[model samples]
Target: MSQQARIDVISGAYGRANRKIEFPKNASGKHESMSDIFGTNVFSIKKMAKSLPKPVFENFRQQLKGGHTLDKVTADAIAHAAKVWALEHNATHFTHWFQPLNDTTAEKHDSFLSLKTTFDNGLAEISALETFSGSELCQSEPDASSFPSGGMRTTFEARGYTVWDTKSPMFIQDGPHGTRVLYVPSVFISYNGEALDEKTVLLRSSSVISKAALDILNLIEPASEDHPRAQNIYTTLGTEQEYFLVDRGLYALRPDLKTTGRTLIGSLPARHQQLEDHYFGKIPTRVLAAMSEVELELAKLGVPIKTRHNEVAPCQFEAAPIFEEAMLAVDHNLITMDVMHRVAHKYKLKCLFHEKPFKGVNGSGKHCNWSLSTDRGENLLSPSSTPETNYRFLLFLVAVLKGVMDHGDLLRTTAASSSNDHRLGAQEAPPAIISVFLGSELTEVLDAIEENRAVDRAVAGTTTTQMRVQGTTLDLKVATLPKLNRDMTDRNRTSPFAFTGNKFEFRAVGSKQSPAFPVTVLNSAVASALLEIKEDLLKQMGDKAVASEEDILAVIRKYITLTKKVRFEGDNYAEEWVKEAEKRGLPNIVKSPEAFKRILAPNNAEMLTRLGVFTQAELESRFHIMNEKYAKEIIIEAQTLWGLLVQHVLPAAFSYRRELSESAAALKQIGAEAAPEMKWLAQLSPLCSDLEDISEELDQLLNEQAPIEDPEKAAEHACYKISPAIEKARELCDKVERLVADKYWPLPKYHEMFSTL
Candidate 1:
């Protein structure tokens, strides 16, 4: 019956809608313009300007721009306008959408309808009316203990608040049966005002980094009205999301995939990504249809999904969006994941966001293209055409290098998870070691800066020369094709953190995890470094209003020397790089537990606390939560693998062996063709025994208790003991799978799952 499920999926015998999804439509049935459909469901600044009084609207705008606290009067006016806008957009209920520490979004919906008591003459009367107030919009109470607080909150003290983030806009989400709810982006905090969610820390990090950066900028160039220091600096991000599409029916058949989001035990297919033909290949028809609907849904909520294409692995694809502010970009990515999962159902597909869904192929990652920018429209990381302007870029660049060097272990912890463990250090993804790749040309430029020599301007040009003959200057490229303008630097996919063009691409982040933590760490680390640079520059100036060119150059040169060891231009996957990194005193932490231990290290904790990104208690809570989460995931995967081996795989093996033995016995009695059956049984019986032995071993490992209170110890045990046992059992299971009859195999094979769609 399980085999039949795989067959049914291959034969396209599942339920899925066949109708076309017409998005961006008007009442007259004509397709609406992108500008018209964009942000129609969102209570945006434009809507606020139209709904609120002129004075109130200006006050709200100033609060957002200036980062000032909103007064009660202003909050009431803004809340009234937002409520009216949400209702006009067909929203009947509202939800405080927040990101919890478990790498998922959470929400609780409340209706706008309310009953008001009034006296009519001598009798009491009840009237129904819609009401929304500033107090309700600004804060909401949720059970703090219900979420993963890492012992920050106990069950007895179950009180948490969701406060409105004024910067991120509120949008309406459509549900089944014409239900629509207003979603206000919020930050979750405990009763004592400790950050209980990802967004709160991210918000604090943003402010810290911006202030630190602005201080340096003010020292270099006095703030004019056009480029004022009061104007907030922002961290911009472009998240490239990668995912896989599997048939929904086939997904339901695999217990491992359903329980652990990966195939724990499956035989590698003969034709899986070996030819390298799947990358950027033609998109499957059904998958394209699903992506179209997903884009349309995102468009209504103001998500700028700009690109889609096939990724490196078969059945894997990528969806990338245009750059936006850090907070909004994280919010939109969460929305994108939700939309992809919800939309895939209509096409009988399941979107897999696991880091490594398949064992032997490439895994998925969220390539975060991160950079710093100012409200004055200047990209801090971008190099200018002239040598003078490039000095400012070099200062910012050196700050990032120093930041990454000092906090390499802490940065690795941001991407730490059991699922991500399988993906990292693989050929297709960056390794566990944290290193920066600035390409060869940028390395040379930095070298020149450190040596106090002139930088070659042509090396920093945006275009590369066309291909030519080996010994001649004549170009042999196609005459009809135009000259291509490439990026200023070559891309390095093997590095965990690489400078692509103007921004750094944090390629080690797991697809299934939230970008908030990684971004927060990155912001805090760079801010700490920037603050140091500002102090150094101030000390060198010694009461001078402006430092001389020599002083500025000396400061930049000092940083280049301090951070020189972290910049690697070689292959991160190469084994030599690991040994070399150790020689350079760089950490190469391979396990999540080791990485988590550094979160509360003296330097890391001090930086985070001093920057106001997280209190000491908050940082401690995160450490416990990450360790506990890692251990729990490993145990779950182990349990699921054990269940499959005991109930599903071993039984299949036994049935096949019994059938072979009986057939051999019957053939022997008739004196006909018994040699083949006997040989088959001989090969299958020992493997079946070995499979049972290893499964029992795995079961024992599962039963072995690590101290529950010590999460670090428990995580280490799970990583060292249970994980290896699971791998051993998987090896035995795969060996048996090759011998078992196709009809007897219970779970769907890899070939069927990868090729059917």
Candidate 2:
């Protein structure tokens, strides 16, 4: 808090202000067209065709297209082809790219060069040769003890394996060290076959849901007009990723962004999104430059990211991709974050994916647009033009509603995290309460079905070709302007689970967390629900002569009546909805830690087990893992806040107080009015004491119960006790920021961060 220290902060601010930015260009002398560079780096089916034999390439493409497995002979052939492709791209090594329990991706590279005993010149010696085999390409062994296992793996049982997931293609990763490695998408698991990674559970759930959906589709004949009865179903996903960009220099100055991925103590800036100017505003030159590089790299990797734009908050932006298979989408999103981080450094910017990097502005969310589709190109969720398809759509819709109503807590739990605690239900994001928003027309149709009454709207209100009457759309209402068309389903930004025109947008998911778990849990719950509905329809048939269509319709009607409570068409953020939700017996999970208990609930566990998504043991391990992660994150934040306040903020506050005191004494000696200095000291003096008191309280909070033996209870204690204390300390420190001289404020203010962009 010395004057010189304050001067250092001022100097840094000026230095940042004078910094000039230059945008880097592609090395090809001219910008490549999207068609020219798209998927160029990927070892795609086309690339496989070029590098592999006719029979081997056809077999590999068949396996990828239809979820079939290749034999060892074919695997060896494919591995040779992949090696040739990677080597052509300057790759010397290959790595199994996997997502661990932590927030990031993990990889361990192994060179293709292998040492072998050879007899050269009649002498036995080890000679190195570039080698690759089916076995080596198929699997990898890595130590799992250091990763978060939550008692799933012990120190003695450190053996784990990563098996190649052929469903997703392998691509070459060009690194900062000028080394290119062939990255094979893989799933990690323990030796005992327990799921140790997010992808394992996701893959299992995909199988379960595909089977469940196929069963339901089989219930109705003439499934697709062009193809036979659907053999397989896939979950389609388009994840919109939001993030913030800070200058690398300023990001280094703030230790919180480095350690926590969020600004722990910055105050709200005066000009942050209040004028509604930044949302969809023109992109900054440097940010656009970085984004262009990110897109180009991702396109080469075949991610197909299609959109990028300024977001609701200053320095915050979003990028989204076209929909892909659920599994591929998850992998693409994980790698997209990595690519963004790396590409951002080229422009001297650090990407912030934290849920709430700055307070008082809108936080980021990974709005997952999800739906179901058949292998024959039939979208199960889309509104059908014919009555037959429309009826099938209603059946699936009712089934999903039942699923969300029954397992709302579990679905909500998937998006829970310590960082998300700062975003949920804050007027910018969806409420913690899970509810379905089916536009006005669809709501009416469902009500009519439940009540056996005639609907005011058409039966298929969501279809583009409305069979009965006119539908709503956007109208500019100007003589010279063109009429803007609208989607069949209206968008409800306030709802956590909204039924968009073609897919459901889960808007509650945090920006930083991977989408694998969220997609897995949701699909699992829906599969369970669909299975239950199928059984109910079969049960209604009994030994009677009732038509199968009648039985299906009866089940749909019953479901509409059962899940009516979860269907809300009004404002979910209002207080009245909260009261109404409680009255209707809906679970409102406000805290992130509270979600773990839901995962432990008997019904939730039983449902997941029955659907083959997770065993009870796996579920318990995951629960423990989440609890430990939440508790540990809070503890670190608390510790970091203590150090930042004690070392920087309080010292700066006290130094300003000292200067005021000295000036007040000088005025008294000169017989001048010392009243202003005395008043300033009075205001600034107590802040020093209050900050010290809060810092002591925070330290005691950490020391008294640093690691509670029970992971669940420790998470609860942190949620109820430790986190609040940290916030209280931050509150005092923020107050000191306002009272201290602007020149002496040590930490970067929000204004400075938003100044450039």
Candidate 3:
């Protein structure tokens, strides 16, 4: 292609910014306002209350709230309502939406109109009539052979059941493909009821956390500190989604972006988030339009998206929602990501959720703001002024730290993926070492507890210390912006897990990764820690007795002392912290393959199995599945790198080298000065030759046979050898890109992408 043609392609992409597109809507009617459209497609609690009979709705609501099994009568009533509502909204099909082991949702749609016999005229005939019954809604059999099960089910044995999770209300989908789908959130399992998806483990982990929390609550005196003992405790999550957007035209041109979801070999972008001007900056017109569509689409589905802004990278942005129950939040995040992609494409852009699409700037992270709330609206992480509440809060905080201390490797293992490896440990993302940042104010409070120091405001010499960390006021000298109220201490961007005021923000999670596994690991780890604390307290009080207030305080102090190493107040990204973390005995496994190995450890297996999160066999299968996924992903990246280098980069280099050689020879033929051309040829020719040499080396590395039957060994080969060669090939190819002429270069340059959008 000519230089003009490439320029035209980019210009054509930019031209899309001027056009405006309508947001997606249902066929029922046009939506005039958010109130009119909000929850219109969702079969929410409100929808259920209105649609079902009072007693039936109340009993069914209790079942959902209490996590009890639904009776056939209630199931039938709910199914009938759901079918009527779906048909009214023009939905012809429904599917059991489930997250399989691949960290992605899967569904096979079935029509509500089932063919049945009527025998009207004493002749054999088929009749099409609506027939979505309770059994169909409650359970479905989808072929299990295609899904990754780690040998749980043979290819010939393709029987799997999907059961509806009653807690997550049914919702009608929007957009062209979605409009026809009445998506029922569900759990996938094999014929023998082996868990096959992240949701299954998550559901079990949630139960474990809830039960452990209730046990602790039950042990405490009811109605203490003006707070009643909670009947139920649930985990909540406010997931912050981060992504980048590039014009789809440019995305189409780059095979690497399409294949591996990142630029395979491009130079470090010159003008990429360098000045930090893009952070919370003005929204680009095209991006704003895309965000508008995303918001409208999500609003109808009952997703409470509360914030949107320019993130710290060029072409990057973030959208965050209010906290909801953890399971629902996980489902919402998946839906939000999907809706964002669809909306971006509607505006001729491709939403890039890859962790590191460009090399020289900040990578995207989905910061999960996690907390626990009671039935009466008490945030467990929030510090209280009363002695009993404050003590309880501190106890839970200490348990979290202990969990991090004991299970940092497991937490990191949950987040391990080939794509995440590029983002972790640098570029505004977390380091491989996991530590909790409890800010300056919280640090001082913990310090006092650890040292047994009496507080200054010790309630007139009483032992009750006021642990309230006063909120900070941000008075920026701006006219329109109000005087901002902020947390007691400043935010820590470097910490993987940081206490951002009331909740812990897990900032190291990759943008594209699912939160189910991470949340499961976190909740399970915390539960295990809490159980340990309970046991230790009982041992101190008695082998099987509840602790008094004094005894509880002593137990809290002991645990604080034991788990102090997991709390880091300094910069997590600093080199000194890495050394410091090593000294602190923190696990610093940076590679995904090695980090994933921790999941199969005896200690991790025992905790997960004992908590009923996963069985022993299930644990091994997960390890195999993840390692296999990592190996395959790296192979794809390596092969993609090879294709571009051999077919495009090598040819471009040769073209430039030939030009330099011909110029040098032609100058000599003309009997003119040829010193500059010869010098240029001397430089250009060798670099081109070296590019091929590196490409060949990479091919050999990729071609080497490993013990394929051993998934761990195969992943190790990909990680230790193949990945390094791919990087080396990229390094050489990037060097070649510099030598090649702008007109001859076959790939989009970083500067072009960064500067344009």
Best by TM-score: 1
Worst 10 residues of 2 by lDDT: 16-25
Off by over 4 Å in 1: 13-17, 224-230, 386-389, 456-476
Superposed by TM-score, candidate 1 places the C-alpha of residue 640 at a distance from the truth, in angstroms, of 0.9
Question: Pick by lDDT: which candidate is best?
Answer: 1
Q: 378 in model 3: Cα distance from truth in Å?
A: 0.7
TM-score of each: 0.96, 0.94, 0.94
Looking at model 2, residue 348 earns an lDDT score of: 70
**Cα lDDT of model 1 by residue, 585-674, tens digit:** 999888888899999989999999999899999999999999889999999998899899889998999999999988988988998989
lDDT of 1 at 633: 93
Assess candidate 2 and give its lDDT: 0.85
Model 3 steric clash pairs? none
Better of 2 and 3 by lDDT: 2
**Residue-wise C-alpha lDDT for candidate 2, range 1-757, written one tens digit per residue:** 3445434544554454322422234687666677677787888877778778898877877887565688788889889888888888899999999999987899999999989998989999998888778888899999988787889899999999999998888999888778899999999998898888999999999999999988877765544566577777999999999999977766777777788888778778678899999999999877887888888888888889899999999999999999999999999999899999998887777899999998889999999999999998878887553323276788788878988999999988998999998999999899999999988767777777778776654554544444321244556879798766555556789999998876889999999999999999889989988998878866887864332777777888899899999999899999999999999999999998998789988989999988878888889999999999999999889888888988889888888899999999999999999999999998888888888998998888888667578889889988999988988887887788888888777666788778654
> Once model 2 is optimally superposed onto the true structure by TM-score, how far is the C-alpha of residue 235 displaced, in angstroms?
0.3
Of models 1 and 3, which has the larger TM-score?
1
Cα deviation in Å at residue 328, candidate 2? 0.3
In model 2, which regions exceed 4 Å deviation?
1-31, 58-69, 223-226, 385-389, 458-470, 473-475, 541-548
Off by over 4 Å in 3: 1-5, 17-31, 177-179, 223-228, 386-389, 456-467, 472-486, 540-547
Q: What is the lDDT for 737 in model 3?
A: 77
